[model samples]
Target: FAAAQLQADKNDVDTRLSQVAETTAAMMDDLKVRPALAEVIKQLIAAGNVVAYLPQDRAPRVYRIDQFVLKRDNYGQFTDIIIQEKVWPSTLPEAVRTALGVKLDPNTDEKQIDVYTVVEQRDGKVTHWQEIEGKEVPGSKSDPIPTDQAGWLAPRWTVVPGSDYGRSHVTEYLGDLLSMDDNYKAITQFAAIASRVVTVVNPNSSLDVAELAAAESGDYIYGEPDTIQTLGLNKSQDFAVIKDVTATIEARVKEAFLVANYRDAERVTAEEIRSQSEELENGLGGTFSVLASELQQPIAARYLYVAAQRKLIPAIPEGIRPKIVTGLAALGRAAEVNRLRTFAADAIQILTPQVFASLVNAPAFLSRLGNEHGVSSLETLLKTEDQMAQEQQQAMAQQAMQAATPAIAEAAIGAATQDPNQGT
Candidate 1:
């Protein structure tokens, strides 16, 4: 069953693996998380597999293949996992030590020791946990460690598998290209050496070979008749061939990783750029789908579960599975910007009196558009129709009062001049 499941999901798994490899490679250029991301990529390239886990009080941690063992079920879902880690005795909390049933000796020197944590999951949920000391199980089977959250406190491992069984980028993609790159570098170095002038002195010539060689600025050779000749091969053609070969190899590497190449001087139109972007999106669609299903959604669910337990986020509504959206952050943002620009243009063109009059639920459509453009707060930023009406009424009332003020004063003065009481 497991073998069948592996075969069934192999294409999907490989797609996601390729995406992760490409993303990791791209992320090596990010300044904020470059160090950590570079380390993760290095491990992936070296070992072909790495594990990501979220600890209680720290950033997500990555472990190499040697640090963990994984067992997958028939559906290629992780069913059981064991992680071995070394921790200092001083780092363990007293309650945790008591729960583990280990008593530390005060006289014994504090030292690092390996702790094995085993987690078993059933039907996509963690069901059991065991902490073992060396080879001995310390705690009773029935008494599990106390956890505020229902599932394991330690987040279950998320395995990032590379291209194949031995998930390694270096092995799969860079192996041959790297060798070619080295050869190119060596050829270039030799070409540089070959460009230097060589001086040959005839035996009977009245010229000092050492002085001719020592002259820094000029190349001159003195010899009897045609005895001395400059010997240097034109390597320009050879250099061009090597350069072309190296560039082709590099371009292959970049294309494999889905990285854009800007080596050529050919001008590309906006339509071409859009077409290429769409093609890229289509190519990575499988990868995005796999990541959403296998990695992002599960990790988000775990985070929300923990948050709900701590009253950080609202409790999960019963019977409704929370929706988690995940993608490459930079790409997602660009997509959003493009979508909003398109929507704005469409809205401006369709919002004329004639078009709006023929539309149904125009208000709702506008609201939806606002939400899509991330302007759900448009109501707060702009006045409602009723509010605008009220402000217009207020402005009219003030105008009427101001317009009547001069007339009222003129009438009052005329009455004062005509009436005896007003004059007095």
Candidate 2:
């Protein structure tokens, strides 16, 4: 349905096009974009910078920071990107083959070609094309796409002012990591030395070195009582110190990466749990925000553009940008659910059930909790306010009928006992 038709009757339009959304989702699943997205996030964290581009003609491509060059406009927005891909010649367009003066070959499957795809916003238009060996490919020129449909996404782990690249968390904890590595190496070498068994021998001893080496634990050697003794590798104390230091360094590094687990006693207080949860949330809050702005919204907008272009969906209304809910914020939302659960539990403990019922909108609370807990079709699962009102009215009517039933029965009995003819 068109936007006007949708706006005129949202329910009907939604019901009609519901299958479109499902089919689109199924199509996206078939494209296997999730694996590409997972790789994009992996690169974002590992390298601190990643570039993902969605071409209407193909699955999204994830490029390493080294594989692409980028330029930001005066306002620090990405304006130009040149990505180099090692593509197979079989995948290239015929125009590209003609430009390269290459004849069709059955062995194209084994061939590799370096192609450069350049996309940039110029003169208020988004232009994109591909080139091989610095010469433009004849069939790879894209018509001027609207800036909003540019389909380029670059999400970074952490932004550095005036720098195009992002800084990874590993770099922030480099000192701790390096120190731990050295400590581990020292501990390992010391452990190897300490674990060795050495039997010291005197020249006066008659025990043969080969015999002594081959002797089992129960074997008896004929030698002077004090002639042969074991020498201790006394590096245990040094090893313990290195081990302790390494553990501490490891903890620090884990803390920096926000992967450290917070453990309490076997029985922990709600407050303690809440505190740890808040700390974790605060740590992820910034990460979630960065991904929402840098990754989520752009992907949603570009997908909407593509869907609209293909008429799989209606054009979006002006000033209504695509807003993603369950993308990067999933982490934050999980935290929020925990927070809400804690709040509800605390409220129940602090107030009587009656008081809690009076103080809170129970239906609203339950609906929110259900949604946060990822309940599907939540709107349909929960009764609407109108439904509640109708239910209340029905209950009242039933109660009134129940109270009036005996009175009506007595009136009918009196009328039957004293008939109209008997009274006359």
Per-residue CA lDDT of model 1 for 310-367, tens digit only, reads 5544565667453545443336435655775676568668796566447644444454
Question: What ranges in model 2 sit over 4 Å off?
Answer: 1-31, 56-58, 91-95, 103-111, 123-125, 268-274, 280-289, 307-315, 322-332, 335-351, 355-374, 384-393, 416-424
TM-score of 2: 0.79
Top lDDT hit: 2
Give per-residue CA lDDT, model 2, range 205-318, as digits (tens): 787888878889998977676788899976678677888888888876776666636674687776765576566667666666677787887776777677777887777778
- By TM-score, who's the top model here? 2
Against the true structure, what is each candidate's TM-score?
0.64, 0.79
TM-score of 1: 0.64
- Supply the global lDDT for candidate 1: 0.57
lDDT of each: 0.57, 0.73
Would you list the clashing residue pairs of candidate 1? 48-167
